[model samples]
Target: MLRDHLQRYDPVFQHAAIGMALISLQGSFIQVNPVLCELLGYSQQQPDSISQLDHAYQDVLSAVTEFGGSLQSQPLPQGTFELQIQQTAGRQLTVTIHLTLIYDEQVPQYYLAQFENRSLLTETKTQLLSTETMLRDIQDSYQQLLEKMPLAVLITRNGVIQYVNPAALQLVHARDQSEAIGISTDEIVDSSYHYSLSERRKTYYEHQTPLQSITYLINCMDGQQKLVEGFTLLINYDGGPAAVGVFKDITEQREKEEFMMQSEKLTMAGQLAAGIAHEIRNPLTSINGFMKLMRSSDRSSEAYFDIMESELKRIELIVNELLVLSKPQSKHKSQAVDILPVIDQVVTLMDVQATLKNIEILCDKPDSPVQIVGEVNQLKQVFINLLKNGMDAMASSGSIHVMITTNEHEVLISVKDEGSGMTAEQIQQLGQPFYTTKETGTGLGYMITQNIIHNHGGSIQIDSVPDRGTTFTVKLPKLVSVEASSN
Candidate 1:
């Protein structure tokens, strides 16, 4: 009856695309489909045992060690595996086997295994391995090139620094790469330029546009400033949106260019001064002679003559200053000057003007002397100009504070005023030749003060907040006393 049933389904079994089989109690094939025969490269005749088809039957036996003792004592096992089989033509074929066991009356009856080709999957895995190796080598080469770049390279996401190369560490004076990571972009940029830079970045990110190169100032951790030209582009970093920047520091070159421009302006000013002095000297001499004659002719108007003479002297003073400013300086004598006394004298001279405006002038100094090597009168001129400007800034009653503080290597004299102060733009233009705030100001007073302070190997720093006040800080290298130097 089973043979009749098999014969009835024979045509269906033979035509099916998938392999199918039935084995007897001894593991010999009782029925096999044509697909199974073709897949295994077998002839029309069936194999004697299923284990004979598996080249590694010992490995298959090891996989079912729990099937111990007599076959009837253990349950049949089932598993999947990849098997390499030698075909009739002696060529090897790799295939996957899904194997199971059938049972009859609680005893092992037959083994059944289905085979499939695995060559395509194996080739795909090999190609993937080669591609991964190539990708890793390319990434390593890019990392090496980034480290060796001379200009600072930075990668940032959401305004937070992510990666910094060696050159970036050097640019910010950082000790190592760890120091700059996670720092905000604002921290490295100069405060004055921070807002503009942030706004520009926002625009670029919003529009998905690349940033153009810009020259700007950056403040380092060491308190030094650098003029940097920077360029930025959007990038995908570590699978997230980010920006990459490259910077070149140009501080020294910019300073040299500024110095050349200043030099040219000075040369032009000198030539104008020489020509003007020649043209004005003759008229000034004639005016002085007439004023003296008028004073003698009219003794009753002696006060008027004194006033005229004073005005003439004031003109002479301005001309003398211009001549000095234009010419290349000859060496001037230097002396050890105790700046406290000079400051005190200038304060005394300016006190009357302060008093007229209902302003109080307060002076503070250390008990110990503050000494510097400079020209005494020149130092006096610098202080006088600074104090006078402080007074002029005050529209009405306010206090002008002057303090002299000494450090190990320098003396700091700060002049602060409680008055309407300057804006940032005004402060930047303070030292230019004809820049001024007062209606009647020539602007030469501040310029000459700056020149004198520079000549004395000192620096001037100004700080102001609009509607609050202004402070002018003067730093000069301290001169060690002879007794101290000897020690």
Candidate 2:
């Protein structure tokens, strides 16, 4: 009897802060703990003398009864619940309930049971929810600030990317958030080193040892690579362990370092070879000029002049290659445009080839206009690149499907090919510059394509399988002006 007393109603019943009660299926209370009496301002009562679960948890009772068996709340699931119960004086009070379904071990039966204070629980939960909402708002504002930032800001746990800022979109050459989120560093990064880095992070986390400092090569999706030096800290999030790393794109730093090294070499080369290059330029121009003069002098000697002229042009091309080390710059603003016209142009360009191969193209667009903010010429380039790649990937009898969709603030275009697709490894490196699978590829085509899309502030995504085909989806944000907003 003494053992039973302690087991049922001793420490937990008298001392625990939460309300405790046993209520029957018929809607009568079987037991009320001291905490329950204090919560509802009722006197402590005997077992089998209590209030009903229906009064306190009407929604839970209804939902459980309607659904049958036990149920849990959504968005955030918890063993505890929020409820309202009445005091003996007939005032209703709100409470937070830690609930359980008591099952008879011998027979098949479930009894509704719960623990919490009625009045205090409601007030506390209400305040906490308000605070949580405020915090979420601040966090949202912070994310927006980060998104507007030019630097690539990312949040990660271990080596997995949790959140990435807008700058990361351009850095990875990604289409958008869909392509960027949940992407592990190893997947988008060029180096195999990130795999080992991930393994090390895992090991440290498993042993609860925080990562101190690390430096290594990291792959970028843009074919622009980097060597990153970073420090990590361990912290708790949502009652669980997490590692947060704040990092900057080290590519520019590496570029500056390489430029300094190259500047020294170039200075020495200029001193040694400056006279030679200058001397050759004068002779080469004179020789070409004399060749052109000779070609016009006699028709029979035209073939010889042609040979000489070809050599001169070849020399010019070589010189141009040397000068191309300094990249060109372009300045263009995003403008409103319809993408259908761009697709039509690509089809026209590739029409002859498609006809020769007996391939068919299918285009689907809405009857209404689909508009977005982007560079029409640049988006045209993106279309041509994607369409040409698709054409190359497919057989003579293949078919290409183009779909255009529009929402209030964006436009989407998807071009799909029914042809040989890419492997997992190839897919991982598809958008990377200089990472082509083709034999005679310069590997810079996709690199240029990705840059064009970034300039337009649009995203491009490639989805493909091993044998099915490839689909390129581009999303461009629509211009949302005050006039549009008012409408």
Candidate 3:
């Protein structure tokens, strides 16, 4: 009966697609199909045993026995394992073996083993592990590069700081990264910029937009303030959205620029000295004439004394304005300044020069005081430069109109001149260093003017027609009054 049963399955076993083998309970092969011989690079004449094919066969047999199933049991145990075996040519191949026990008449016969080749799967897994390791190494290298870069770098997520490079730590006077991480960005940025920064972050988070480069005042951990110019872009970090900022410390650079501006102011004052002298001479002449009249009469009229006093005061006012322009601004603090008064004072100072050029400066003052926050001297310099430029642009008698207008959020001061005017290309080149339209102009005046306005959170717009005229419109952020703030 056993012989008959074996004969019945012989054809199917011999023609099996995968490697197949039948082994006795003693672990020696009872039958080996042609596929099994070819898979292991063996011939029919070679010795065939389960132990010879797999070194761990004993362990597998032990595991099968530990499952508490006897070889002669009715329901036998079956299992699968992965093993590496050596072919006849000494080459190793990984394979999975499915082993099962067969029975005839409730008695165990032999173990049937089916071998499936898994060399390709094992090789593919190894390649995948290698690729992952390479990617990890690349990430580590980038991290090192970021750590060693000189430019300050900061990373934030959801309005909270997540990482700060060493340079950023130094820039903000932070002792370590832990001091800055996990803190709100508002803690470091100046309060004035909080609203704008918040709005920018919102835009970036919703649309993945980038922030343009701009200067910011950062409050350091050590209570010092630093000026940084930076730009930010959105990036994917750790499987989430983040913002990375690259910055440079510009505090020293700004100080240098301030010194250059101060030097230019002095130079400009020197250029206007002739007009100032002419202005002072009239007042001096008036005082001299009044003194002579007082000396000639035994009882000088009170009007003569009053006239002398008025002339002296006028001289004093001109001298004071010159001194203010010539004096070096070592350290100027920004404060709430009434824009109208500053413009009035500038118009007064430049009026002498304007008259010398036969240019009448007609100032259209606002009914109410327009207020802004800025350095008074710098603000003076801005208008002085503008008014001077207007005077220089005109060749003959013309009016330079100074108009002050205000809105809820900003104050606009327009200096319109009926000069030769400028082409669009010339207007575009207004703020460049050493590029001037005037023959004697240094071109630094407009550049410095633009810089001052920008520092004050303001902007300058120029509109001109070639033959008609040119108008320079300056816009500055308005200072909210106490009442307005409370409201």
Clashes of each: 0, 6, 0
Q: Write the per-residue lDDT of candidate 3 for residues 1-487, one digit (tens) a residue.
A: 6567668768977889988776666655556677887877766565544446545345544443433244345444677777777677887789887877776766667677788988889899999999989988988997899899999999899878999989999999999988999999899999988888888877876777678887788899999998899899788787898889999999999999999999997786665665566667887898888888888989979998888887788777556654554344434688989988899899999999989988899999778878898999899989998998888889999999999988889899999999999999998877644467987554556766777788788999999998788999999999998998999
- The model with the greater lDDT, 2 or 3, is 3
lDDT of 2 by residue, 1-487 (tens): 3245336655666676676655444434555577666665655654333434346545545543332233323332225556565565787776566545443443323334555455656668899999999999987897788779776666666567777777767766676877777777777655667666777677776787867766556656666666666666676544666665545567678889999989976874674366336534764886777677776875546666676676567556445433432233146666677667877887788778877788888888887556666667666767777777888887658888889887877788898998788887887776533356654343445666766766666778888886799898988786666677998
Q: Between candidates 1 and 2, name the one with more favorable TM-score.
A: 1
Considering lDDT, which of the candidate structures 1 and 3 is the better prediction for this target? 3
Who is ahead in lDDT, 1 or 2? 1
Name the Cα RMSD for model 2: 22.8
Please identify model 1 stretches exceeding 4 Å from their true place.
1-76, 84-94, 116-119, 266-487
Badly placed stretches (over 4 Å) of model 2 are 1-330, 481-483
Encode model 1's per-residue lDDT on 134-244: one tens digit a residue: 987987897898899999999999888999999999998999878899998888888888878888787876788878887778888798999999899888888899999
lDDT for every model? Answer: 0.77, 0.65, 0.80
lDDT at 102, model 1: 53
Off by over 4 Å in 3: 1-77, 85-92, 105-108, 274-487
